[model samples]
Structures are given as structure tokens and as C-alpha cells.
Target: MGEGAWSCQQSPAILLAMPAQPASSLPNGVVQSEATARALIDAVVSNELSAFRQGPLSPAELAAQTQQPVYRALRCIRKWEKMGVLRVHSVHKRAGRPIRRYALSAPSFFIPAQVLPLEDVAGIVSRPLEQQLHAHVAHALREVVGLQGSEVFLEPRRYGAFLVSAPGQVWDGSGENLPVLANRWATLKLSYADACAMRDELDEVFARYADRAGPQTYWLHLRLVPETSKA
Candidate 1:
């Protein structure tokens, strides 16, 4: 191993002797800087890197876990360290060189709405989910006999967006039994209490099916935003 290599053996007494930062000193996971927020978002949404959320990890460990290049991981760690989003959790002496482990300064991060536009942030976060949904539908159409030749599309309405799926020519031509896609929309007028009750009911339904095991997997995106004149 090189001078920077770390060993499994660590002295508990030495580790315990090191002065630790008080928990109260941390940022409480709220990130204010736009640059740091953007960097963290990019790391998550783009690379799917989330090792830092678990605990302190060396750059090499992060690279191995995320499948990112070691240099890239180190670069991000260094950048975050400078931005105060990450801190050195501990240092271990290995072959006369000190190996540092980095962890999130806070347990998690929250970007304030004032720091970035809600619409832009939502778009950035939802892009990957949209892509994944499309890819899954495409794969199912190719591989699943029942869903073969089905069409999935998005329809943007005046007040809301709709994702619709329809049987294609092949499926329509065949009289064999297959799953049917439902298309329905309605404008509702409800009191505050009724709206809250509806929301709670929907949440319960979601929670019930959120983790169920199934032979096939599906994705669902539900939004219940208020409709405005500009919408």
C-alpha cells in the first residue's frame, strides 16, 4: 500500500482523545449559499452520489461506493470542505501520511426557497425521475407481452399535466385480454376541511402501496397543486 493508504486497525483511545466539534455548531442541514446548494444538487441528481449522507467516508471509499472516479470524488470533497458543507470527521496516520475522512457537517441539507426559484428547483429534481419513468415504460413495451406496442405520452392541459397511456395498433388489433388505461379528469370545488380530508385519504392510499412487493414495478407521480389564473 502507498503512504496514503489506510489500515483497518485504528486506536479507539486516540480517536476518543481527539477534540470533536459540538453538534450545536453545525448548520442544522440548512444550506444558504447558492453555489454550495447547486454543487450538492448536481452531485445527487447527476451522479447519484449519496455516500456522504450515511457517515464519514474517505475519498477512496466514496469512489468505490458511487462508482465515481477517485479524483472526481476528492475534488467534490475538497470543494464541499471549503464551502463548509463537509468537515473532516477524523484523521488516521497511515504509513507516515494522514488519511482524512469526511462527513456532512450537518445530518442533511435543505435549500431555502428564497435561494432558488421553486419551479426551477422542481424541474431540476424531477428531470431524472421523468427520464426514468419513460425508460421503464419503453422497456416494458418491448419486453412485456401485455404492454407490447402501448403508447405512453404526456398531455399538458390548461390547469394541469396528464400522463396518458393508450393501446397501440398491435394491441388494439388483437382481441386478447390486456390491461386498460384509464383517462379521467374533473374540476372540483371543495371546502378547506374537505380538501384536507381528501389529501389525508390519498396519503394513506400511497402509504399502503408504497413498499409492497410485486411481480412487476410501476412508477406514479401525483401532484395536487392549486390552479391559478396564470396556470
Candidate 2:
């Protein structure tokens, strides 16, 4: 996605809902300058996409959803609209200006994955093709773990299925050795069939938002490594 990928955004903001509040309840910290558009985009991509698609942000919803001023939020919405991620789903013709409802053209905004080739990579450099793949995975794992730290989830399967998400929440995975390593990382070893299911879900989600992040927005880091080894 290059450097400018993270700053992109959508318009007709539906995912965020500001709650009904008296004028006094409006956040004093509303985004001041247009320069803060990057922050609005960041918040939308990182946390609001799932919610926005459901409906438009009512005046009440806007106050409840974001601290940015309504205009600033609108700015982000217009930007996203320009990016082509959001589109008109409906229009509420009020007494005054028409209220337009927007929907996401896609579910997710994709953040580019970074693959750093390790210097003097062990296990991979001199190993057979099969072993080299293992080494490659292991090396990639280390890099992902080192960067994401707490964000990199690893839970054991004996506890239950790790890929399962609750209700509308997604982004779930766990590993067997996770219990052993309080601060370490491990793979979410699913049965081959189960692994395939998780892979499909991830691919779906990844495809949805893979290209939404703008140029200046902070990137969300994600990596999935699966293992077929028996317990």
C-alpha cells in the first residue's frame, strides 16, 4: 500500500453513531483543523468499520460515537467517499437538506502486510525445501511476535477452539503452547479442516478492507500462522 495508504477514509459515515445530547454535551475537543483528518481516518479503520456499515450516525449517535466535531467527522466521511469505500445506500429527505445514508463498498480496509526478510536466517538458509518453509514461517513468526507483542494472540486448543469469535466480534485465534508461555508466542494449531475454515474467514475479512488504510494513518498489524502438528 505504500506510505500514503493509511490516511484514506470513506464518506456517508454510517458505522459511527453519535448519541443524542444537548448542545452542551458536545465534546469540547472536536477536531479543530482539517489537518486532523488523519486521526479521524485512523479511528474509523481501526475500530468503527464494523459498526458503521449497519446504519448512519444520527445526531445523537454522532455525539456518542466520536469526540471529533460533527464537521470533522463529515470531513472524514467525505474523504472516505472520495476513496470509494463508502456509497449512498439511502437518502432521508428531511424538511431541510436531505440526509444521505452511506454504506461501505467493502467490509474491511486493508493494511499492507510487512514481510521483513531476516539477515542470516537460521533453519531457512541451508535447509531442505520443506525445512526451509518451516524456517521461513518460524522466522516470520518471530518478527510478528516481536512487533505486535500483546496484539499477537496465542491460545492453546485443548482449552477449546481458538478461532471462534463471540457474537458479532471476530479476530480470534489461539495456540496449544500459549498457556506455557505467558509472554511468549505460539501457533493456533487447528485440525486441517478447522484450519481451512479459519483461513477462509480470514481471507474474506482481509479481502474486504485490504486497501482502505490511508497514507498517514497508523497501520494495524496482523499475522496468522497455522500448524498441522498433533498434540
Q: Which regions of candidate 1 fall more than 4 Å away from where they truly are?
A: 1-29, 44-49, 142-189
Clashes of each: 0, 37
lDDT digits (tens) for residues 53-166 of candidate 2:
455554334435766576766766676556554556567888988877655544433221222122212122223334544555455446432223222234452332222234
The model with the greatest TM-score is: 1
Every candidate's lDDT = 0.58, 0.42
lDDT (tens digit, per residue) of candidate 1 on 29-148: 667787766665555555433565557889899889978899998997888788776788899998986889987676455667787565656566567777876776565445435433
lDDT of 2 at 191: 82
Would you estimate the TM-scores of all the predictions? 0.66, 0.31
Instruction: Tell me the deviation in Å of residue 146 in model 2.
Output: 26
Candidate with top lDDT is 1
